[model samples]
Target: MSPRAQPRGKLANWGSSFLPGAYAGSYVNIGSMKPDAVIADLKNGSLNRSEQRKQADLLAKLNRGFLARREKDAQIEAGIEAMEMAFRMQFSVPDVFDISKESQATRDLYGDSEYAKGCLIARRLVERGVRTVQLSHSIDGYDIAWDTGHGDIKGGHARLAKACDQGIAALLKDLKTRGLLDETLVVWGGEFGRAPTSEGKNGRDHDHYGFTVWMAGGGVKPGYSYGATDMFGCSAVENRVHVHDLHATILNQMGLDHEQLTYRYSGRDYRLTDVHGKVVKDVIA
Candidate 1:
């Protein structure tokens, strides 16, 4: 992302991993909702685009004096940037989130679950030329959603997979049919893998020693598996790709050189992959 167009980075996904760490005031959390529904004044359809900009200008003017007090106040700049982005989002978001416009077959492809809707929306966003999209299969944390399996690993996983797998499969199929798959990269997996051994009666504990992440499209070789953990799935026994390596490979796929892509802050340069990252070339097509 261009440092000059930082305000537009408001479109960045709110997920911690998705947001840029070096760029302060770079991200604003926008859910799958129209600007009209999100902005309080527009909820009732009273403020049109022109009126929204007019108010934004007025608000900016109101903050001018307050902003002049500091040479580089990220908070003040972020406020102005948010107002500008809210105006810009008015044009694209509403239409993207409205899946009612999609055909029944298309909808059924993703199934009729909340995860389905997310997958469908992600497809729509990609179809419209969105560069990156992330989908979480279930809720956050290890207690409720994907992190669980501590008590009834069998039934728990079965039910959760039932809720999410259809949508993911449909997204891949839909994107391929639409020809977006070749250009879009879809990543699926969690922060860490579940333990092979049981925690309670059937549930598993977190195992950071080894985990798996699968990538489809975006130049990734199809069905090309790399690296492997031991039989117990307890630790890496073969090619171990660090998170930095994964980050570098992803940037390489996007035509970026991880070593050269640096952001300067506090008199030092920082990299997304830091000082240690090697592109896993074998994973590339």
Candidate 2:
């Protein structure tokens, strides 16, 4: 009962943490927590020091089985298979990371590289009934994957773009071919976009003022573009869509009312839109 205790937002469900969205599970840090303790410790960081230490040790063992070079092959494979099965129980694709010969064509079409492989895998996941799939540009914890301006923009983008262009184009083409495009939503964008004014060298810096992000399928009107930037592409000029708006539009397409999709916690309701979202009707069918 203090003024500072005023309700600020809506409540949310603990399980909704698994919900798919823009960055679907991006912020989770499983570094020092065991798989069993993930949800519990993540939500309530009040575990005793001893309990925390135990969790950390379990996590270390799990990491070794998955990444340690000295670990036995049998142990690693077993761990992987178990994890795959667990993922299957919740996700539509029971195989989790299973790859097939038929996927070779899809992979090649996406570019036959890691990026392409990932995109191809994403296509497979969505096709198998997964609601949302997110593929980050980072190949191996290297931000340089997309932070091209750091050095060699031409070479960097060329290497990455070859795969990206193929993967994205193939995904769009494949989705349409199979009629999955209507039910599946595809989003392509990053935290922000690169600046239009070349870094005066080769690459460009981050430009939040204006950038480009496109969405296809999932009830979105095809061949229709949204928003525009200035001549220099430094700022949004017309029909600018904010990130919150994008989230709103996505939730809408999923048949969830952004405002009503609430989770109750601590006597309040919390929703992803968080008081700021307008369904961009123009972008929807």
Q: TM-score: which candidate is best?
A: 1
| Clash totals in order | 2, 8
lDDT of 1: 0.71
lDDT tens digits, residue span 30-84, model 1: 2333323423342326877778778879998877778887766656776777667
Estimate, for each residue in 34-138, the C-alpha lDDT of model 2 and write its tens digit: 233212223224765466556656765776756667654544544554444333343323243344444567656667555555566667667777666656555
Q: At residue 246, what lDDT does model 1 achieve?
A: 90
Model 2: lDDT of residue 110 = 67
List the candidate 2 regions with Cα displacement exceeding 4 Å.
1-96, 140-144, 198-200
| RMSD after CA superposition, every candidate | 6.1, 13.8
Backbone clashes in model 2, listed as residue pairs? 10-269, 10-270, 11-263, 11-264, 11-268, 11-269, 11-270, 12-263
Candidate 1: C-alpha RMSD after superposition: 6.1
